[model samples]
Target: FFWDRGGEALFAVNHLARRIIEAKTPKETEKSNNPKDTLAQEGLGILIDINGFQKKHIENIHAIAYMMAERARYFKSNIEIDPMPAFERRIVHEFLSDVADLKTESQGEGLSRRVVIKYIGAI
Candidate 1:
């Protein structure tokens, strides 16, 4: 179905899809040794990206991470990003992994978890 509500709608659909998949998955399959079953249990195997919205959203995330990293470096202080999902936090961490003068850490609990960019002395 076509959704005209933009990114918010896409996110909602994806979230609902994950929940539905989780609800339908068999409890036995969740513990199975098979890779396919494990993948299903993880809920990372299913994503419905409409018209590359996910890709564009990821790029926006990268841009935000870069901006935040620069702010941390310029201010020589730690910068806390708003809470985001694990996958998004992972993107921020990996995107900034190679910066010599900065470090990324995940903080907070559960849904409030977010990435913090810490300014370290330039190498």
Candidate 2:
């Protein structure tokens, strides 16, 4: 079965998140009966609000990497992100692959799998 034709699913998530945040929906607060299953069906992960008004697909690799880099630099230690789907994790890994002072790794198994960002040196 084909999932997410082109990048529509990701765009859908972004749109949905925006609507939810804007209170465009009615007061009933209609929520998906099975949020996870619904996202799976769309071949998408989660959607998170960036800043205050913008909603971004969880596959937002650059944002994730930047946050990781910031955390690692601030704490001077490895930073671990919450579990993400394989495709999303791959995005993070690939984006950080060329950074000289940062290293990335995927750890855990199944749904618990997540990404770890390590500070290798000053950049």
Candidate 3:
């Protein structure tokens, strides 16, 4: 049996979010679908729009998130020259094109490691 390509399936949520914003599609709700429910409520859209992003352009956000995550996983550990920070900076530049203000930090003991990035008012 094949393990299957999980990345495409994983991106479905992002695509739905993209559709909700009408960037990908604007198909209305079906009979079984509730109007009250929306992509914003699903909470999978944590990777939000940086700036100048309307309801559309959701796919750009997802693409950035995927790139960031892929670059994030390349780090071996804190002691081994973590590349997460540099990668995050690049992501910020890609989204903003102007000055970039982002930082990536990793802190943990043993195998329970964590990586996080935040903006420092860079635009």
Q: Per TM-score, what order, best first?
A: 1, 2, 3
**Residue pairs whose backbone atoms clash in candidate 1:** none
lDDT of 1 by residue, 39-71 (tens): 666655566787887888789899999999999
* Tens-digit lDDT track of model 3 for 1-123: 111362333345545665666543223342225444454344324333324232234455436554654444444221222333332333433553432444455555544443444444424
Comparing 1 and 3 by lDDT, which wins? 1
> What local lDDT does model 1 show for residue 99?
94
Q: What is the C-alpha lDDT of each candidate?
A: 0.84, 0.69, 0.41
Worst 10 residues of 3 by lDDT: 76-85
Q: In model 2, which regions exceed 4 Å deviation?
A: 1-59
Can you tell me which runs of candidate 1 are displaced by over 4 Å? 1-6, 26-30, 41-45, 82-90, 97-100, 105-114
Residues 33-120, model 2: lDDT tens digits: 6654444344343454434222344445678778888889888899999997776787788888888888999999999999999988
TM-score of each: 0.66, 0.52, 0.23
lDDT of 3: 0.41
Name the candidate that leads on TM-score. 1
Q: Counting only residues 3 or more apart in sequence or on different chains, how many pairs clash (N, Cα, C under 3 Å) in candidate 2?
A: 0
How many backbone clashes are present in model 1?
A: 0
